[model samples]
Target: MGPSLAAPIEFSATDVNGKVHQLSEERGKWVFINIWATWCPPCRKELPELAAFARAHRNDPIRIWGLSVDTEQSPDEIALFAQSFDLSYPIFKVDPTSLRIFGNIPGIPTTFLINPSGEIVARHVGGVTGADLMRMIQRNQSNK
Candidate 1:
């Protein structure tokens, strides 16, 4: 097998509610670290779908995190966006440096699927739906 890429699986970011979310604390569960922005249309379109995914998988060993990478937007604006949608998951406002773990973020709507062991299993660089999220979960759990 080819040498594996070690994505930085540890980082901390606060949610809109002022709760600090650390990837390490979510051990023994699946984690979805989604990097998105307020101005990205695709990202906007996928928010609710992702919220559905979060609710659907709330009881499962998985988590869906929506991190806003909008460097130009205010937290209040992002919070307004969250309120408008009544998002199911916490929306984290991260600085550009905090997202360095993902490496060379070219655009919005990037998602990383992490397994229970804290290993990144999938990295999607665009929008995703509830169906897409479930399939990835099932596929990865089956492998485990």
Candidate 2:
């Protein structure tokens, strides 16, 4: 709920393809790093909208990534889940130790909005509506 616009955090995680993707490479774009688990209700509910947003703004400099924190799910299962949602953006299988470095994730469906300069702009810890996401993008544009 606090304003974390100036706080900086570098996210280091690999994509589904197993290639390492660093936040340093995602500069000059507003990256929506959505943290979710397979079993969370709100995570499941809002994921489709997230996918649609990514697809709709394919040409935009915005990148949405779904980071699954589930330790029990395999890569194939995660791929199937991504396919089921028709997800357009990248979905990464994150290590629990990696996640723990970010924060104590006691809940599911947490989101972090990173600006073009790789700074954490905002943090949403629950279900986010499509309108809410749209407004975030609009705000990011306005800042530019």
User: Which candidate leads in TM-score?
Assistant: 1
Tell me the TM-score of model 2: 0.85
Q: Which stretches of candidate 1 lie over 4 Å from their true place?
A: 1-8, 142-144
lDDT of 1 by residue, 30-97 (tens): 88888888888999899889877877778987788888988877778888898887787778888877
Off by over 4 Å in 2: 1-7, 100-106, 139-144
Q: For residue 127, give model 1's deviation from the true position in Å.
A: 1.1
Per-candidate Cα lDDT values, in order, are 0.79, 0.79
Local error of candidate 1 at residue 11 (angstroms)? 1.0
lDDT value for candidate 2?
Answer: 0.79
When summed lDDT is taken over every stretch of 10 residues in candidate 2, the lowest stretch is: 1-10
What's each prediction's clash count?
Answer: 0, 0
For candidate 1, the 10 contiguous residues with the lowest summed lDDT are: 1-10
Query: Model 1: clashing residue pairs?
Result: none
